[model samples]
Target: MNQQRRRQMAENYLVIWVDGNINMANEHCQNTLTQLCGVVNEVNQCTTAEKCIETLQENSEKTSFVISSGALGQHLVPEIHGMPKLDGIYIFCGNKQRHQEWAKNWSKIKGVHTSIKYICEKLAVAIKQCDQDQVTVSIIDINEGDASENLNQLEPSFMHTQIFKEILLDMDHGRQAIKDLVKFCQEKYQGNRKELKFIQEFERTYQSTLVIWWYTRQCFTNKMLNRTL
Candidate 1:
């Protein structure tokens, strides 16, 4: 993808796969990409450390995870470790023991793994934690001062959320609202087969009484809602 397209495709999180021996023609490489995509939609491949650093700089506002070969990671981690957008780094190589020695020095280094499956599992946990951290409720001290002044001093995010809640509570969420929401979700998760299936199930069998059940379920319903909020 072009640089502009990649920037536009940035979501809540992305994965960057960096290795000196990455070849798209290789079946192993293709399989690794597929496995990583299963956990995060945007999986970018970089054949060199410089390209990986460039990609990270281009999308500096996005939350990113890097999977780097042990050889490259030894040098690359130090260069990108301080990047605020870089969430976690995983050393992918055959010599786990060798990499683990240096990986221990960096707190952001998730682990030294020989398999993509374990990396994906860890990535899922990190992404979940990031999501939870972003959706936080801030309590304001209204009793200490003027309510209006205190409200004005609140963060923009909190104010926006308050307005959204007020508007949502006043509106009538009837059949049409549900249908619209289903349509929006379908468009948002166009290529994600798993989430698309969940959206279909929700559309087919959703009711007002099941609102709490759906929201509490670990599916697209809660994920999308949290992102929107």
Candidate 2:
């Protein structure tokens, strides 16, 4: 581990609570967690599976743990697994058997708890451990290779910076990461028409690294694209 990795580990993490009925989650899960996870003074709450996914999309870098009730867990857990920077994900289930069956497919899921106390206790421990884990960051030069080759080589560098960059472009998660990278690129080049137009098409198409590689290659090679918007 190096200073960069330590900084990443120390980055503030949010504990998200997902439930179809936000009120129930807040009253039971949020209230209990607010008391237990003091490091996370406030918890982000989402009412539906879609909202939960959107929340994760927007804050994946800061999310350490997520607690989803049975209603939302079925949809939320799978999405959580796809997220980057998340240390743990758990489900609050009323039915043990059904969740157990679902849990079989999601090995990364921390646990399924019937009581709020159990979930909070486990989350607190996991949060502490995740916060403590550290790594050193490395920089990669995209200038060394062709667009496609550079895209493949840039994966490690992206992982250090983007967190979820390891997911393959063929997977849904990978495509989402590319979309995120495009957004990052867009932000990096806010006023550049060419780059912005390229990103717009990237978002509209349903494709893989071939396209992302082309875009990244263009960004890397075109000196004009380098100037900040």
Q: How much is 60 displaced in model 2, in angstroms? A: 2.6
Backbone clashes, each candidate: 0, 1
RMSD of each: 3.1, 17.3
**lDDT value for candidate 1?**
0.80
Worst 10 residues of 1 by lDDT: 2-11
Best by lDDT: 1
Where does candidate 2 clash, by residue pair?
Answer: 5-135
lDDT per model vs. reference: 0.80, 0.59
Best candidate according to TM-score: 1
Give the alpha carbon lDDT tens digit for every residue of 1-229 in model 1: 6542434342476679999999979999988877776665557889899999998998788788999999999999999999998999999999899889999999999999999999989988888887777676777888655988877767766876785565445455778878998988777666666677888999889876677688667567766566665
At residue 172, give the lDDT of candidate 1. Answer: 59
lDDT by residue for model 2 (20-45), tens: 66563356654554443333334566
